[model samples]
Target: MPTKTKAKSLPDGQLDHHAINEFKDVPIRATIEENKKIMEELFKDSSDIVLREFDIENGPKAMLCYVDGMVTTSAVDDALKALMILEGNAFSIDRITEQTLPVTQASKIQFYKELLTNLLSGDSVLFVDEQDTAVCLGLRGGIRRSVSEPETETVVRGPREGFNEHLRTNTSLLRSKIKSPRLKLKSFVIGTETNTNVVLAYMAGIVNPKLLEEAEKRISRIHIDGVLESGYIEEFIQDQGYSPFPQVQTTERPDTVAAGLLEGRIAIMVDGTPFALLAPFGFWQWLQASEDYYERFMATTLLRWLRLGSLFVALLAPAIYIAVSTFHPEMIPTNLLLSIAASREAIPFPAVVEALIMELSFEALREAGVRLPKIVGQAVSILGALVVGQAAVQAGIVSAAMVIVVSMTGIASFTLPRYNAAIAIRMLRFPIMILASIFGLLGIIIGVMVVVGHLAKLTTFGIPYLAPVTPVDMSDMKDVMVRAPWWKMKKRPKYMGTSNVRRQRPEPEQ
Candidate 1:
């Protein structure tokens, strides 16, 4: 037995003013006029809402309601034309859905909230005169950017296709790479007002179930008004909140996402954004790049060493220069020490002060360049750094040695493959420089120790932040320190969500 819906007699566009109790349990009514009035009220200020009223020759009267920019008008016209020419004395929901309409997704709506939501979410709702239920036609259409190589994560030799703003499009890109039933995507609608779709993707057998559960649990607890980016989801669900380092990695490349999936990591994709979050990330991964695996293992391994040296220079070069020049001059050779002394004799500021001035000026110039238009930004950054450094040296504001060290450190920071990881190193340089100014070399040691301890304590969703090295997983070092030949590497990193540990089994050579 079903309860009949009583039509509410209210003025148009008055649903918002009504008390919550008035429509607490209201459902779709048998009267089409009341439903139309309710929908019009909900979408009163929206001029883009299209309500197309039509009649069947020998059947029930119906009206189509949808947002303008969300759906294709031609598809709606085709479906409406097919329904109007149907040969029937009465309208049957099943018959109309099966034969009359060419729509692929037509869902029946019984509740008022469901009706309104479907209408707002790019689906056209067909309200009938006598029916107690409405039909939701899937006709979403809008201007979306086509998939192309991401400007941020572009590689020399890899798939150029990248994730677009559409969630379905992003999922399809991943699915095209790994065509297996094991790949699973579980969706959850988050955000109270936005109702943003957040999806968790991973391989069913390869991904650890516990890791999946933890990720799902954290995301479910996020109750908010909206989620504008994948970063919002990352902030809410990351393992550490106070840590400066990014516990979760974000990438625009589908190949990177696919590789993360194949390695038994979970990727979180937020609707309306292209950047996806890959979880259980490690510290070593920050130093690696997409091209590392694309090239020869030996060449990749050497590049990894270069990146490691660059990271060191980016963080400690300025601080070390100040320390050695101010407190450890004995460590320098006689000729170099005499040369540095001669350079700094006419400088107005001490080594620490000079370094700080140059670093701050460089940072300001870097920010200015980034905010400017792309065409002029790179030229501005390069010219600004060069002109400022050279002028400051000639004016005796900063020594030439200081300029050289600052320039070298700036160049080293750009060596990093990912910008997010480079940010952490960049932020730490200032603090280390301050310590060197106060306590000299010992202060630098203390600062380094504190940062190392913080990183050791940090975790990316329960996996050790400093894994394979601190815990000494020698097998994992093949890909971490040096990119071991793919054939030589047989097992996946342990306790990091890899289930099918065997990646490839090479035949033994005699």
Candidate 2:
């Protein structure tokens, strides 16, 4: 029969305080037994939680506990064979104490808190009946999707590997690229109920200590029931809670995270989520791509400019069309104005309404393309756009000029490298369009000023959101407006607060 204890009476604060203090001194053996007792009490309905028992000759009987589906049968069999069948001498818990245990095959865990943590992490725990300690073997297994290319960040010229849900695998991928001692990874557990593992990765010497500390404190203060994804942590810790723009950038590529870390930024990886967060993000960083670094500088610079130009078109093209056709007819060339006026003459709604209708329809079609199955999605999006645009013009519901404007804006928005930044631009288009309808070109200018003002004021963990642009750092501008050759990028971005500024040595001629 299993032993049971009644709940101890205490205030909530006092209970937590006592639990923390009690956990500091609880013996490993007692803690394991208590955890088993608690788990049995809490998970009484769970039949898959298994506990296996075995004995060491002339020593205490030991028990191993693990979730059935979470552990591999082959590994368990090998461990059992090594501990029970193949041993030349009688197995003894006293002989395999913390100091004497082999680190090569099995990891030795001493503290009670660590033992409990390991057990909860899906590893099988070995508990000696009469001993005061337990051994935790590092063998965790669970069902997970195999490594595949990132769905959101598909690239034409780069490594196709993407991050998996496993924290170790994600960290390993980063480690594989940056084989430097300066790389540091700090792990913590968040969420009282879920106890999700969160890792903070950065270069020790490059990252700003103050910024790192602030990020750590903010995350530590998140007292919640669970953290299902990196977005949960992002929402809880964002500098500007009301802003639609994302302060922290998330990516599924380990290469991206590793590059960010090397540049004095920090990465946050949460358990059970493939998306990882990178902090101290700037507006221009969203326009950059890993492919940019791999390609020639001239090609990369041209692509960067193209993306920037596309961003403007995405945000203001439709609004400008509505304003020029309705209010600022003088801004358009005589021939173009005549063509637009002729097209609008047949449409029932005003230019503003026509633009809105076409934009909304385009957005709806884009969304449908995403939610639908892959085999049919691309075909639907292509055919839907062409069919709908042509039909809307023929029906006189929307002008041909408005269709062209909306299509241009949609294509422009697709050039953004970061999805979150692209989404912010997409959302801003509607408000600007409304403003254009009311105050014409003046309203559009005011909207742009307001957005620029907000961006100038915004800070990502104390780093300027529009760094090296508003501040005008000539040295860092090389990487922002153009992709400088690897040899020319002599220093890291000054705003990053890196201890070592120079990336390469001065030439002998200099």
Candidate 3:
């Protein structure tokens, strides 16, 4: 016989166990009343649990247990009606699962842990008198956001469909694109309390076995209380936590995840979050966008170069301005120097102070625009920047030249393809600006070297963060420095260590 110990209470006078570990492995009871008592004890003071008791027609007593609003009540009612009207005199959980349950998805569960897991995941569990096992019916339903274009990662010429919070829906979206038996989504239950389901998606034959094993090891090592989003998993499993560059690339777009999977990379998706994570990410990927692959290679190459220009501007524009105005004025053109000097003559703060005030204000306004309602966010951000910049210029708090520089820098930052990458650049800007103010151009050089050194040292799942660049792989450069036309590109990325290297057959020689 299993023993029941008194559970301790918390300061708030609630049970502290929370069904974490104490009752997980307990076997289902042969007696219905005893099982009901245990469930009632587990869910004490909870209003959402629904345990409906009924008798099968000419058979044993039975009950349906589910969380209200999670399982579809109409489906549950239909299943119950079917069970009540059964004509057979002999009945068992297996018999009902095989013949009676109208639901398409149903399974038999024997342990309390399995029962709780199913019930909590929106399945209806049918328990019968004298039966030690319960049938878990697939009746999960509730209001969920319909799949729509992602707000974060929009593309002009690529597929607009994005991942939603529903885990099954996301997997189906990926499946529809790949349509191959080789594509596998292995599931794992994480989060001790939330019991969040996480799926590791990869192409079986193409992905390196060692990479897959390493990914699994990292995921299994995570022991969090709950995982509310994919971000939680990214932070836990990534190779470097403190690096500004994202070791794990996050995407809300299914096509992006599909692209990553096809390249012999693996993706991690969590339940209840639209964002999914891709591993073994490289620096060049941050500069590339989904639209880059959709358009002509020539156009994509030009745009990539443009983004490269913007990246440098976003990262070093303000620092350069501070360096030039404060220490290297002689390096500037004579006429341009006079104009810049004239603009800042009446400014009350040093060039660095001027840049900080404007940069911080710009960042704050950008954040406010994002958090506010979309209708007014743009208007407010634009109007706020205009008002603040014009007023500061008029009051001599900052120079007109500084206003122009900061505005251009902010615009440049927006051109980068990835939001997190833009954030990293934005964050690095301030320190670089301070460096410029102190040791002038040399400080800026030092900062750049430090950042580069960090990038060279970083790795994601054992793949170099700056792959095909630091450790040059000429074969992979076709997709990096330039987007080679589809015909010329005949192989997947070499850094991923995939076994299946060939992506397409050689272009027919004219």
Q: Identify the leading candidate in terms of TM-score.
A: 3
The superposed Cα distance between candidate 3 and the true structure at residue 455, in angstroms, equals 0.9
Tens digit per residue, CA lDDT, model 3, 1-510: 977553443456444344444446567878788778777877889999998999999789988899998877789889999999887657767779998889999899887777787788888888899989888899999888899999889888989899999999999999999999999999998987888989999999999899999999999999888999988998898898888888888899999999999999999999999999998888998889988889999998998888989999999999999998999999999999999999889988999999999999998999999999999999999898988889999999999999999999999998988888888999999999999999999999999999999999998888888998979989899988689998888899888899798899776889
Judge candidate 3 at residue 31 and give its lDDT: 75
Candidate 2 structure quality by residue, lDDT tens digits, 407-500: 8999999999999999999999999999999999999999999999999999888888999898878889989979999988988889888766
lDDT of 1 by residue, 424-491 (tens): 99899999999998898999999999999998988888888988787777777888979998778777
Off by over 4 Å in 3: 1-24, 506-510
| Worst 10-residue lDDT window, candidate 1 | 15-24
Model 1 has an lDDT value of: 0.85
- Preferred candidate (TM-score higher): 1 or 2: 1
Error of 3 at 27 (Å): 0.5
State in Å the error of residue 67, model 2.
Answer: 1.3
Most lDDT-accurate candidate: 3
Clashes of each: 1, 0, 0
